[model samples]
Target: MHYRVAVTGLGIVNPFDGEGEPNSGGVTDFFQRITNGQSAVSLYETQDIPRPISVPAVRCAAFRPELRLGKALSTMMERFAQLGVAAAFDAWQDAGLDKEYCQASGMTEASGVAWGTALGGLMAFERGYRDFWQHGRERVPPMSVVLGMNNAAAGHISIQLGLGNSALTYSVACASAATAIGEAFQHIRNGRAKLMVAGGSDATLAYAVVRAWEALKVLSPGDKATAPQACRPFHPERAGLVLGEGAAALVLEDWDHAVARNARIYAEIAGYGANADHMHLVRPDQNGQVAAMNMALNEAGLSPSELGYVNAHGTATREGDPIEIAALRTVFGRHAEQLAVSATKSAHGHLMGATGAVEALLTVLALHYDTLPPTAHLDRVDASCAGVAHVRGTALRGSKVTSALSNSFAFGGSNAVLAFKAVR
Candidate 1:
């Protein structure tokens, strides 16, 4: 029998702060900021590049993993792993499975960790390379290799949580986290595990990462001197994406298991679909995107008209946004006009591999609360991307949302789409 998956808890570490600002700390604060159209994109300075260019980025400047994680472990972890561990801790606590309590109950072995990241421990990797090549250091830190691996975050989560089931990592570019969460949901659905910590993390603000993006010429222009609304998705004057760093984790449990435990169910993981385009390295294909969405809707037993909202992968790039709109229109037909399409990246900046996990959590929260976050900075819709119900200006509240989808179209032609439904 095919089992169902339930989202029991969520935790996040984004550029958002609870200091009456746009930074999202947790689920509630994140929803509030997005609904308020607050932009977290700001000018950040880094020595990763030669001249230290000022680029628009979203960073968790306030996150002190030491306060949450112990000093020793915190120091050993790189920024991405730290964010992942912090989010995992919050998720574990939120799910009412305290670390000590879980160990006491002997449930650690039944749990697993599945995470994703595009560039793992990027900051440390850059530093280590610099030290070895430029500074000619005799020896690097012992933990440098451990921290530089793409599976480092997953390994850390498994160790910290004492999970022995399995620890898996996906590196499918931007769709990484969504793929992880989807696979974790399948693990629970197949009765392989009763619970899992699933998410994605990336801290790619290093000089090499930024310089690579700059070379692609897909990054938006403007520094500290410009306004926060630099990356405007679907706007007529849209520039490009602003990369950010963050982590998000969701606690997925079996439906019957969660219900038996009397746990709070935020939403149900109804369906998941992923496919690849063997076409281009960077440019997205409408056919591939449509296939992904259709597969998800089909698996969820949902029609295009039944899909209330879509957390679009609107990276604000001219080539990407219009193609996404075309795919939606083709799949949803006339229903596309009634759909609440919102590109939240306009406010939070693109979190690379971690983006899908963040958006998936937000989508589940949206379905639970019946509130759709707006696409910030959508001043004038581009003529090519029009004809859809783009939620702008304010959050669409009190809408009867039965199901929603989060779309992640990454580089390397990977497309992952996850479907969520209200826990009715």
Candidate 2:
């Protein structure tokens, strides 16, 4: 028998405040700021680079993980894992699954963790390299290996939450987090686990990482004045994507189990579809995107007309934005003209592996509140992206959004789409 998967809780460690201050309001504040069309992207400069390159990007400037995870626990992990653990803890608490409550209820063994990150522990490794190459040090940090591993986030979350079922990690470029969430949903739906923490975290703001992206010529250019408006998806003059670093998590529980515990249901994770282009390593294919959307809609038993909104994977890249819009047009046909579409990356910047989780969380909130967050900084929609009903300038409130989809198309041609429905 297949069980239903429900999203009971949500958490995020994002640059929601945009003022170099800590965001204490968790997911509630995240939703409000996103809908209000705020931009967290800012001009960031590399300290270690000799030339000191500056670019428009989003960084968790105020994320002091030591405060959230405690000094001892935080010291053992790198920034990626630290962000993941903090987000997971918040989601666990939001789900009402405290350690005492879980132990008393015997819910530990049936729980698991699935996380994603494309450049896990890159910061830690960079520090070690700087010490050895720049400072001429012979020894690196003792915990470097453990802290720099890709699975560190999942392992820490699993241990902290007393989850024994499984602790898995995915590193599928930008699609990593969406894949993690999709697989976690499948695990619960297939009766393998009753509850799962699914999310992704990425911290690739290291000098080397930023330099590599600069080599690709896909990063948006900005100084202090233009940084906040650098990522304008669907806009005619949109330059390119802005890199970001953060984490977001969702608590996926079996429907019956959550109902039994009287957990607050945020939304139902109705379907997930994952596939690859198999054509190009970097370029996105319209066929692959359309196929993924069709698969998700089929699994959800939903038609094109039933999906009220689409959180597009609009990276603001010229080629990428047009292809994604074309795919949506093909999949939705005539309904494409009416379906509300927006890309939150316009506000929060692209979080690499963590982008999907953050956007998915926003989509869930959109369904729950019946409000559609706009694509920030979209002054003029490109003609190629004109078929869809773009949400711009400000949020659309009280629209009765019953179902929605979140799309994640990554650099390696991997595509993942998640379908959700309001619990009401």
Candidate 3:
């Protein structure tokens, strides 16, 4: 018998409230910001770059892990690891599983952690290189290795939360976090665990990191003046994605187990699909995207017409938005025109590896509240993208939205789609 997975809790830290500050108000605050068309993207002065070029990107203004994990533990963690642990702590607490309760219930040994990231500790790695190689420093930070490791976030969460079973990390470019959450759902569905902390985090706001993206020519060219309107997904004059930093975690529990514990269920992970393009590394393949969506719908036992909303992986790049729209049209046919689709990246900016998880949480909120977050700054949809129903201007309300899908396609052609259904 396959166990059903229920989302029991959620925690997130995004640049939604400005720089470095956690969305302390949690999902409620995030939803409000998205619906209000507020954007997190901003023009930041680069310190590591050769010239004084201002790049548009998302940076957290503050991160106060000391409030939750104490100063000692917080100091040991890099930014990404700290974000992961903080999100996990919020999820754990929200799931109603405190230290005493977990000890008594033997939950410490029954659960695990599965996290994701494209670049583990980019800042740490860049700093280590600068200190040891470029600057000819005698020694680097002792904890640099721990901070830069790909598995650091998952490892930190496991150790801090006493999850004894496993601590797995996925690094599939943009698909990382969605795949992590999908695997966590599988762990519960397959009876290997009762609960898990599943999500992704990335803290790659270093000067080198931003410069590297600029070299690829895929970043937005928003100077300090046009930061708010920089990322316009599917819009006629869309430029490119603005990188952001964030961590988002969800508590996935067995449905029956959650009910037994009187836990509040946010939604159900009805289906998940992940695959590779086997095509060009940077160029997206419509066939790959369509296949992933079909796989998810098939696994969910859902027809194309049953899908009410879709959280698009809209990066606002001219090439990406059209390709994504074409794929959606191919998969859903005429029904695609009626689907309430939106890309929150236009507001929150692209969180890279953590993007999938962050958007998944937003998708959950959309389904839970029956409200559709708009694609901010989209004054006019691109002609190629106009065939579909784009939620723009204001949040669409009172829609009978029951099921939705969050799509994530990555650099190396890794694609992941997760299907979520309302519990009611």
lDDT of 1 at 238: 91
Which should have the higher TM-score, number 2 or number 3? 2
Shift in Å, residue 150, candidate 3: 1.1
Each prediction's RMSD over C-alphas, in Å, is 1.8, 1.2, 1.7
Quote each prediction's TM-score. 0.96, 0.98, 0.96
Pairs that collide in candidate 2 are none
Model 1: how far residue 25 lies from native, Å: 3.4
Q: Which stretches of candidate 1 lie over 4 Å from their true place?
A: 18-24, 47-49, 101-103, 225-227
Model 2 Cα lDDT, one tens digit per residue, 123-241? 88899998998899998998899999999999999988788889999999999999999999999999999999999999978888889998998999999999999999999999999
For model 3, the local distance difference test gives 0.87
Model 3: per-residue Cα lDDT over 31-129, one tens digit each: 788878888888977554356658788877665777657999888878888888888888788888885555678887778999999988877878887
Error of 2 at 352 (Å): 0.6
lDDT of each: 0.89, 0.92, 0.87
Badly placed stretches (over 4 Å) of model 2 are 17-23
Decreasing lDDT order of the candidates: 2, 1, 3
Cα RMSD (Å) between model 1 and the true structure? 1.8
